[model samples]
Target: MGGKQGPQHPRTPRRRFDIMSRYWTFLLVLVRVILPLKAEETSACPADCACLEPQHHILCSNASLTSVPSILAEGTLELRLDYNNLTSLDTGAFLGLSQLSALHLSYCGLRNIQPGTFEDLHSLEYLHLDNNLLESLEEGTFRNLSRLLYLHLENNKLTFLGPDVFQPMDKLSALYLSHNLLTELSNQTFNDLPQLRWLYLNNNLLSNISIKAFAGPRRLRKLSLEANNLTSVPRALRQASSLQSLRLSSNPIRQLGSFGRKLRSLTELYLDELGLQEVSSTSFAGMRRLRTLSLRGNQLEILSLPLLGAQTELLLSRNPWRCDCRLLWLYVHLQVMKSKVSQGEALCSTPTALAGQRLLNVELQKLTCPAFGSHLTTAAPYKVPTYSATTAKRTPPQVMETPKTTTRTTIVSLATKATQPPPVQHPVPASNAVPERWDPCLAELISKVAVRPKGEGALMVTWSTIGEHDQVEVRYSTGEAVQVLWVTGELAEVELNQLHMDTDYKVCIIPLSKHVAQCTNPNPTQCAMSHTSGWGGHIQPVHMQPTPSHSALGTGVAVAVLILVLVALVLAGAYKLRSRQAGFQRHFDEDGFESERYNPDPYKLDGVYESNEEDRKIFVTAASQWSTEDEDKLDCRLATSPTVLSTPRYVTL
Candidate 1:
């Protein structure tokens, strides 16, 4: 009750009036508590424009505002101060903007972001300060923005940036610092940004980088350093194992080995227009997981076999190459690897011998090595014949000194000589008639064939020449093919068995113009027709045809012993004859062998037995004197000999 029944019936009206007043007061308090009070929008500006949308938001973009308006408060959650002529952001300008979440200062003439410029914006999550004249960043400038997640500093004139620019932004995920003048980065700069994911450092003047410049933030997945002045890819970036794409196409690194080790994890590599030569096997060895490699527009002489790794598509166009046997080997190897060699214009770079030759045009199987001299050394594991005086007499088509003294006799088989077929003379094409041609058979034959002598006085020719050859030039592949024999005719019978055995070779008669007249038909189609005795003044059948020396083992031993005995006998005969002559001449005085005489005939008297007393005296005196002894006794000389025998003068006197 109403004040205990309204202070009695008489004062009831007064009590009721007082209670109503109290109720009205209570209602007034309730109204003050529940009523919606509006926050002040920026009313200091023009009436037609909306500067501050709410108590927490303000968009002053292109607002003709020179500096920050004073209406902003600590509760502001977003601000757009872009496109302004402001050259610098003053510290404490946003002092009370603690709730600011998005701050866009893009295209502002912000030459510098002073320390504590954004210190009050603790709730800031997105910051866009792009298109500014910022040359440097002060440390701890953004220390208060702990919740900042996205930071864009692109299109700035920043030459060097401090590591602590983003130090407070622990939850930052994307940081774009592109289009800057940064040359290098300091290690541990990115260590604090553990949750950083996307980092764009492209379009900067970065030339070199420290090893651990980007060491931290293992959770970072995407990093781009493209369009910088990086001559070579940094080894530190290879530690970014999660990296998927790397573009190093426009750098000056030439050798493939320089980057092979660092790019083992890269799946896509762009190396276009880089200089390269013969890439060694170790270059691409570690990049086993690599799938795409771009090697377009490089200086390569040959595509090496070892360069072709498994499951790789090689792009080797626009390069120089030496299309020879080695290239042929490479071509065959590539085909076996099943990796397509792209860029078809990759022809032989040799403009002279291999001009306009496409790699596809050459038949690898038909590729023949150029003619190498027989005297050349080879590393192949086969015993090739070596030239010597004794081995020279066995080879046919004798070519050596004294062409006229040596003879070549051609004896035709009396019966086959009449029935032999004429030599087939096919017209060879001008192109094919060149010194060299692309013929597979010739190549195979040269690689697999060997030549040697078969028997005494017989030259054996064995070869597998499947392809057409105008005339096979058969010479002692290794030794001199000439024979020194005593046969006064166009042909001579020499010995054979000089060639290496179990070897294939192509053998045909080469004309000997110096020793014989030119025959109408020198070599016939078949070997039998050409080898008929001495058809073309070659040699006798027994000598021209290779007859393997068929000596039994015992016979060979006996022959060797006979040769030794013959040599011994000749030496003994010469010795005995010399001894007998010496003995017989010794009896004759003047005619005998002269011994050095002490006294010559002219020095002695003819008839008288001359006394050599004076000579003997001089001889004894000279023999008794020694150089040192004489010098020591220089003062003593007193001995003389008398008449009969030069007796001791001192004793007989």
Candidate 2:
């Protein structure tokens, strides 16, 4: 039940009838689980497969059918051998689909599967080997998929998945290895998937991911790694505290490693098209439940980053922004969150008479800069990443040598990053790389508490405050009362209520401003009490859970099998976290069957990039090329290559 699909612009017809009413209500749940048998000679329907009777499915897509026609009528239930060329699947390849439940071997040039080729599909549950040419997968190739719940090995050529390669997929919950060529992921590689909640290793070539490869998903909400080469921010995802969407767009991630101030159940983050030039006002420190951030095509100029998480909503379109005075405080914060803090129109590209205006329509007194010799430099303060799994110590990645002429910026024929492509420069890893202080808390730096369990004994404490913090104290003790609630102004969620039911308590969150600080550590604390206390930062202990009754018969069948596995994981993580989509980087722009030498990353780059354009649909329309005859065909190809363009360069992870 991993839903939240998003990305299909709203030209509205009820948003295209709500995506065809969610694909006809998930095809009437595969036509009520297929079954109408009893029709003669192997249910006759194989020549160029299209069997539709009682819709037991089977649309042998682009039928170059390399054999699977195996007299299949055990009520065949959905099998669409996509764009076929079936390289190899062999071994009983559906020897009578035991009621196959959706299986689309996508764009199949399928390069070998052969391991009990889907052990007689015991009612398989949506398994699409996306645009295949799989590289390696054995652990019994999803050994009889335990009611597999969506597992698409996106555009494969899977590099190496080995370790328990998704072993007995314990009810796999959406695991798409996006545009694969997976370079690494071993230790408990997606460990015994306990309903892995949507983990699409986006456009892979992943540089060794495995701080215990998500030591076995415990409802990992969404982790995309958009175009990987991650440089830090993976202290094993601090054991995924039920992580809630983290995409890391076009990675080459350098800094902002403030490991998102310990994820606190992050709310959709995707540092867009990474090539970011500057943005650290504690680059989203402790993401106070960040709500959709994506600095679109980056190279951001003068963006003193601080659209803090408390209510963040930005995409910032194709960034190359600039309007100076350090971006006039985001053009006066976009005139106080105008248009709820933008989705596009962040244009500007520097003073060639304000190149293309609209960094929030310039003029904050013409956002000045240039006090002297200024090709606009001064962007230093950012050494984020704070890795700590108990006393951090992650060495290697101390390249800090910028200030070398403010780190290379040789744009010749104006931007578009000289025809992008070459972001494999990892940098940012010498763990605990500080540099971010000053917190008289005017919001955007402190006070974040995240509890959950809102039933028996109650608790839903979701906070985030810092200054003028008039109220908000919440304290759980298990050994007593609601402890304390208070909560006022800028109220960031609260629910406390009584206590001690299935007791697991130990919560805390202070934020009451009157400049009271006196809890100077001495260990033990559910966030100290006698009220006002002397505080001394850096304490982190996190681990922020539930259930019930004095029963008989051995904890009442383990609490009725843990309340029917927590009511099927709270109804599939609360209907996909209440229908997620704080613009989840539009899941790399909703694939839309992207294949054609899979991802020919194009943004009209030339100077050097080798493509990775998010899910390159090669500019289908920016109004068919943003005017001036595409800038005079890119200034006649930079005046027939007059050289020296340079830009994308980073390397050091």
Candidate 3:
């Protein structure tokens, strides 16, 4: 048995070999991995600081340090030295931090930043110098930071900024310069920043802004000029055709001037607390796409109702609104808007009947006032729908322009069947009010209009009715109020007298449509009918006011109609000729796409390449990974500490 190997003895060598191999692996990990990590932590990070791994983001906030530490890692991407005592920055202070992408130096009592301080930070994107005592930045202070995006200089003591101080940061987007002491904004102040989107100049002492102050940043979206000394809409804003949200509140402005056509893209406009009174006829003339108009805390008694278009999120709180017949249109508008509103301070500070009550709480017919002037344009008493006792709670939803000279929201007349319409009531007319040109009232109604002399001052008007109706109303706006003359028989005609020789009117006939039940039905399929009680289409209304020489006027109109037909034919021929020539000239596109001339993909993307800035993560495809690190995951979250705001004069500090 000793000479021959037993079953247990044969496995001794193999088990010993396994134990030795495991021991060698443990020694290797301690020497190469664990020891090196400890050494690197001590050498790379400064004392009294926290260093995040992989990205090398150093957080030295609230450490009470007096100066910057010299031993910093070259691969550091972000450095937070906020809440320290770095009173000033010298030239080339961060010379070795070439890879730094974001530097937070806020609340450091920094009074000055010398030139060439950030000259080596080529990869810097966001720079925070807010909550400091920075009186002025030396010219070319940010010499080489070309990739900078967001710059925070708010809550500082900066009194002026050189025109080319930001010339190196062409890609900057959001700039916060609010709560500073800037008294004036010169030409080319923002000329070098074409990609700038959000600009904050609020809470400054800026009483003057040059015509070219906002000239360069054509794509600027959000601009805040609130609490500044500006008294009017800056003309420099005219160049910003892509401007969307503009804040000009609390500026002591008393009047609103012309908003040129270039501001048509403005969506949210804040004119609150301006104590405004006089508004030009064309104050909001070109803002066709305006969605939000806040007139809070303004000293105004009336505003043109036509200014309120569809889908508008209007804010009219804290204002003295006159809720009368002229303003009844607004009450109807609010009802239609339903829940897409935030009128926090919306209350009536007007006529004794509606005083101190919410506008929505008042009844529609109770909002009565005097006649409307011809200077305005808006809607009149539209077709009123009577709800059943339970229908008010069950009303589902509801969802037009009248004449320009006389604005009246009236619809088509249905030919009378049995009963005559009720007599006209003397109330406020929508003489100055009209719906938008594309409003449902006129767009669906005016197929034919007939008018002739019925008496010395009266004219007989007739229109095509929609359906047989027990009651029909001849809706016309030729007097102080929207005149509703009842037609007795099947003919849709009524003679309306000219109370004054005013040049304005449109024949809009509103038929008493049937009751449209808008209740919450358990079966949605059975209640598929629309929640509306009127017609909607695209058409033009007739305006037939007789001239002094009735005979010659008829002949001239015939000649004018013939000329218009000839011009239309000529224009069509020219367009066809030009299109054929352009098609022959087209061969290929920049994208190497081939298609029939004048024809492309439905999205028009077959022949063009647009890397839209709004598209997130949209890019061209790549075959190889040049670098392992993805910048999209970079830690760019800003600190959420309480920002220092210069309190308004009314509040006790």
On TM-score, the candidate that comes out on top is 3
The superposed Cα distance between candidate 3 and the true structure at residue 219, in angstroms, equals 1.5
Q: Go through the candidates in order and give each one's C-alpha lDDT.
A: 0.56, 0.62, 0.66
lDDT digits (tens) for residues 1-653 of candidate 2: 23444533445578778999999999887766654433454457788787887878868789788766776667878878788788888787777777789888877777778677888787798988887777887768667778889988887788888777678878888888888888878767878998888888888888776676786887888888888887656677767877888877878865555552346667787788778777776656455556677778888776655435324666787877756566765676576567776545688876666777677766666666541112322233334444668877864433456654443332223245336432223333332122243232223434545567655556675655543233434445644433434455455675655544555566666443222132222123224222112222334445522224433566778878988998898899877655544233343367544242233345545313555646553222211221222113422221111022111111111
CA deviation > 4 Å runs, candidate 1: 1-57, 73-76, 260-264, 273-281, 288-291, 296-653
Q: Write the residue-wise lDDT of candidate 3 on 456-517 in tens digits.
A: 44556655533222123344443344444434455556656653332344444443211111
True-vs-predicted CA distance for residue 346, candidate 3, Å: 3.9
- Cα lDDT tens digits, model 1, 9-56, are 888788899999999999999877666433233344332225554555
**Backbone atom clashes (below 3 Å) for every candidate:** 19, 15, 23
Order of candidate numbers by TM-score, starting with the best: 3, 1, 2
lDDT top scorer = 3
**Which sequence of candidate numbers ranks them by lDDT, best first?**
3, 2, 1
Per-residue error for 347 in candidate 1, Å, reads: 10
